[model samples]
Target chain A: MEYPAFLPAGDCALSVEFGDAIHPEINARIRALREALERKPIRGVREYVPTFRSLLVLYEPCVLGFDRLVKKLQARMAGLRGVAEGKRRVYVIPVCYNGEDLDFVAAHARITREEVVRLHCAPDYLIYMLGFLPGFAYLGGLDAKLHTPRLQNPRTKIPAGAVGIGGEQTGIYPLDSPGGWRLIGRTPVRPYDASRAQPILYAAGDFIRFAPIAMVEYADLERRQAAGETIWEVREA
Target chain B: MSSGVDRTLRIQSPGMLTTAQDAGRVGWMASGFSRSGAMDLPSLRRANLLVGNDKDMAALEMTMTGVACIFGCDCVFSLTGADMCAALNGQPIPRYTALQARAGDTLACGGARVGMRGYLAVAGGFDLPAVLGSCSTGLKFGLGGFAGRKLRAGDALPLRCPEIPVSRLSERVLPVPNALDAHWRAQRPGMQLRVVLGPQAAHFTAAGVEAFLSSWYVVTPASDRMGMKLEGKKIEAVCGYDVISDGVAPGSVQVPASGQPIVMMADCQTTGGYAKIATVAGVALPLLAQAKPGDKICFAAIDVREAQRLARREAAQLRRMEIW
Candidate 1:
């Protein structure tokens, strides 16, 4: 509801709110703040977790006080420029719309399965944040027609690479976890690999677009991934 | 904690939930990795220091129950936190003290004697690779720890063997009194954790906030390292329960539509969409971590500055004890 409200997440952290809703402008502002902090490291701030509309800044209580840290952050915000207005990285992920809930989503939306798949792969979804699981990107900007409620009875274990929709959100499960999201498809490429030097595939403030593939193509991509090939493509524009 | 190993700990019977943990995995929260680490950090440090290892070295974090492990080499070890009635080779060993375990010695650890979790630290620390910069187990994503899972039977943990035998070197005893220490004594009359209400305090009605502070809650059976579900007075919300998804820290008390509060723990997700009412102070985490299921809990509102002061005091106390 408000912009720039410094609230205590705990004694050691502060959640700096930019706005109440998930909007591109608010997310851009958070990304700007994060970039500024990274460029010029804060004295006591350890890490910054940028979410839909807030930046959770974690610091050591023994090193700095809450009020003093807020004051320092205020000064930084006052002089902040449009850093996030520049180039936004994009991730092209391939998915096969052969998930178990494909027919269910189509029936609920009162559209054909092809139409549902078309709507799902239409937009370049904005990765608002990564949470719940490691490298599990929380993407925004799903088609209104495909906005379906989660399963009444959540599934016990949704496998990794399953593209899912829950409420007004959509994302990919990087790991197998018990979740309530409606799965529409599955991706062979992993958003997260613990053994990788980078570990995570993408970051917050990036754009993710789904590329539809046939069942045979999915098998090919899966085989490539298994053979140590980078399936996902990253384009900087 | 240092590289190079000479000994190994072979698990004969894996307890209820036992895993290796260190301080935690940091600098990766933005990527959605949970800060999974030792629940009772103070006890972890004490146990590690007692065994002549670095304070934050990877140690066995036994929850509720203990493991039946066998030493593959002669080494020194120590146990802390909730006593699990541990015995080396059929002889009972004391908590918070270093002991000598001969090669092939069978160390059996029973259920918790007091608190809900315990820590076992060996002399040279376990020779586990640091996944994502920490040895802590991230159970959610199945990363870190021994093959990214809890301790199970047939898992042999490679560890560094102590260079000197017990007969050659001086005995390693902690400087602090081994009696029911100050920390445990203060938490005897049930758990009363301090809270700093905010971040989403505006989302809740004043009466709802009042109910939360004035009520006593019970930890439900459905609880784990991720979060503790507390059932008590229903904390009402204003319009709706859902908030725009945001980052959540450990100890965040998130209240959903059901009016129940789920206090995030050491292994909770990095972000959550539920509206958080308050966060328990860092100083109270050790006590909260030790709280067992069915334990009564009360909340006391404390200013953020005061909570920070208490945290500083605890850190100072630990540092003072570390000198010995």
Candidate 2:
């Protein structure tokens, strides 16, 4: 693969563009660069934000100038190696497919509600990135048959743990806020908990699989989660 | 440091949008957290210096209006950023200078006369719990600051009192004239913010880029800490506006389908799908922070190297003040 183009984001940050389009290969390269920077930390490098096809590197200009940082980043890229596939963790999140927009989604896809649930749960979605909101995971690999457009008018408030599909993408809202995605279900697991040792439950390269549950089980899991129990089951992918 | 004395400040009236902030929450963008810090960082550092506190010490960042609080112990403090017409015990106090306040003294401030935000730094900084390695408040996540929210009436904030007397040191050390001089320039209207063409500059038409540089954009009333919405000539996009959601840096000038540009600020999200036309230089970010609604702004394009030089010069000047 050719070296990514380095573009100046601002005086304090630089964006290394791997590709113009979103692909798993490009995302893997981004994750590789992030891991390299982490293992061999660079001076003045304040933060690393990885997106679908690029990595935004923010640094302190006082300690490292833009030109010098660019040279260093280029050298690092030259020696970049592909990340070896490790034991990836797949989190099984329990969800009750009884959201307000379930019927709307069913009609839009020209499929029954049961078909929508099967299509949604069949694939282990890849976590592309986390953004838009805190703990909000932007996941990929949604079934093309279940692709639904976002709402024309966004709701005033979408409760946290609302699993929704927007176009070809699908995600879970970790916090309650106004959103426009088509809600299909609600998860009992809280992806974002400030009281937890680690606030966010998922990372960029993790996989998530949804498990359908009954309303009674959903209520019981909610009670268990509120009582400080880990409800999501994790296993090596 | 002894933890004997319990010094505190009772909030009599919490102004518009007051929150506890330090330098910022760093190294957490990967976890989906924005660096929520003082919008006007230079002023925050200067205010901390005036109060003989560390440059990154947590202080109260007050918005357009200022907060009113009563001190439970004698302490020295300095007000910076905007001129809020602050008074202590009903007597007017000057800005950019450290002043002593007696126990039970009530400090009040009125609407801003100059900039958009103000900083109030106590002697030893506010003694607030750190969340994710910062005292700065993340309003979106409700993670840090005083209960992860803005200050309100009847709230008492604990203060870390210094061992040595701060009032005595105030007489020996005076306010840095260079720092104050730069702040004066920031208060002036019609700021020309320098920016650099972006990673996606090719996405826009040549005329669109020209219109962006030539037009004077007025800050919209919808502006907030997230971003500064600007109203100006429509910068027509040759390509579509949507892009694969990517990382957004602070000071990024993103042009959505609406044709209007929005300058991302400190509280902006980690990733955005809009195409970026330009990004404001780091040295000029403080100027954008001070700009209030209805303020006029113009843009000038500079290369990445020039932007880095300007940033270095600003840092050198701040260092000359002996604050950091």
Candidate 3:
């Protein structure tokens, strides 16, 4: 861990990097600063992405000069310590652990299928940042015991809502994107529905808890969700 | 009274990669959405301005070529960016000037001979619904533009025109001291890009940074709207090229394990894990956009203050010359 650094992304944007590593404290610091900016507001700042360890802030160059903007950001960040995260909610994702690679992951980890499920559903994973596809929540807190390597050859198209694990990371694909992640399960809920007013359901810093569901229940939930019914609710964490 | 025309541009033959685009889809990068839009943004603005539409009005962005279209109505239009070898019904037409096209008049925009990507803007702008506050096509997610994808043959793009005034139909062209044109011409052969050393510049060794600045990288064929892969010197990074995935801004020059730089473009994914050495200045992005694959490009380190200053200067100049 180093001193909070203001690294320049470009002329119009800057990355207020908390650290080079991805730690919960580093991420929390980045999120707190973003939350403060979102509430009180900065005039020139257009948008901000609170990622794993940095807050990449895009601003209008004409409105606020680069040097001045950095000074302003520095002043705001000075008081961010112990500042609580604005709002945190855990979205309970229903996953049917019957994916093609579920057994493979269990075998690789030298664990039973039931043990794998228990480990996967145990921790409340933190949404590090959304990337690759829209509403694709990159989760943290994956149990080390279930850590499995990605497939040797990437799949052409992993189905949307396909819960997969690659290396140490576990995330659900919001779109049918080509990925190397080992598919362990499937979820019925759509994290991203463009038809909805807010295209994405959850933002970075939100928590995600995967709840195991049976195949029959999964089929029924999938059908209901397809028909625009809300299957899962956000639990205040 | 209005029996002579209709408000639509019927596509006879879609170009290589024709799609509707605006300035960009702003305010959604945090949601993992790329600012998918016209590659040569200034050209899009200029075309829109010539046709008397707002600077960011949606227009057809024909990449590496121009689209073949038939005017459904008598409308004022303007073509800008790369010399698309455009012709009006078998006759070569002029770009950067407001031109009148009659109903049923055909426009054939051929392959680019100058730069890559052409913009065709009609008066009153395109009649397309904006998704996520923009008409720019985000093809990766199948969102926005012509049903969220590139144009195909027989696609009828409607126009929002309430008849152009007869008095306003005079031949108006963009006046001299064209900065965008000058900028494009300046970056021709050498095609040097100015960059601000990065959020992850420390990830690379000092010699690596020096090598990156010195080497002349050629744009690879795999380059597209997503990113431009460059190959030249293998500038090694300290430890490894992997970073704990972070926000990647447009023009973020990322170096993966291979040690080659990949300049993220207009439609690049919002975030990446590769260690970024530098970020190309936004002011120089349009120049880079016009670069063809195999074009030799190099980088120059510029300070953030100077970078923002140049951007502001260009924007202010464009604003002044916009209505003139």
Q: Score the docking of each candidate (DockQ).
A: 0.83, 0.80, 0.81
Off by over 4 Å in 1: A82-86, A107-112, B1-6, B162-170, B175-189
Per-model lDDT: 0.87, 0.86, 0.87
lDDT minimum window of 10 residues, candidate 2 chain A:
A80-89
**lDDT (C-alpha) at residue A102 in model 1:** 84
lDDT of 2 by residue, A70-182 (tens): 88988887787765245577989999999888999999889999999999998888788889888888888999888899999999999999999999889899999999999
Determine the backbone clash count of candidate 3.
0
Give lDDT: candidate 2, residue B225: 84
TM-score of chain B of 2: 0.93
TM-score of each: 0.92, 0.94, 0.96
Clashing pairs in 1: none
Instruction: Report the poorest 10 consecutive residues by lDDT, candidate 1 chain B.
Output: B175-184
Cα misplacement distance, residue B156 of candidate 3 (Å): 0.7
Predicted structure 1: lDDT: 0.87
In model 2, pairs of residues that clash are: none
Candidate with better DockQ, 1 vs 3: 1
TM-scores, chain B, all models: 0.92, 0.93, 0.94
Q: Candidate 3: misplaced stretches above 4 Å?
A: B1-4, B162-166, B175-188
lDDT of 1 by residue, A59-167 (tens): 9999999999999999989988745844778888999998888888899999999998899989999888998788988888999999989999999999989998888
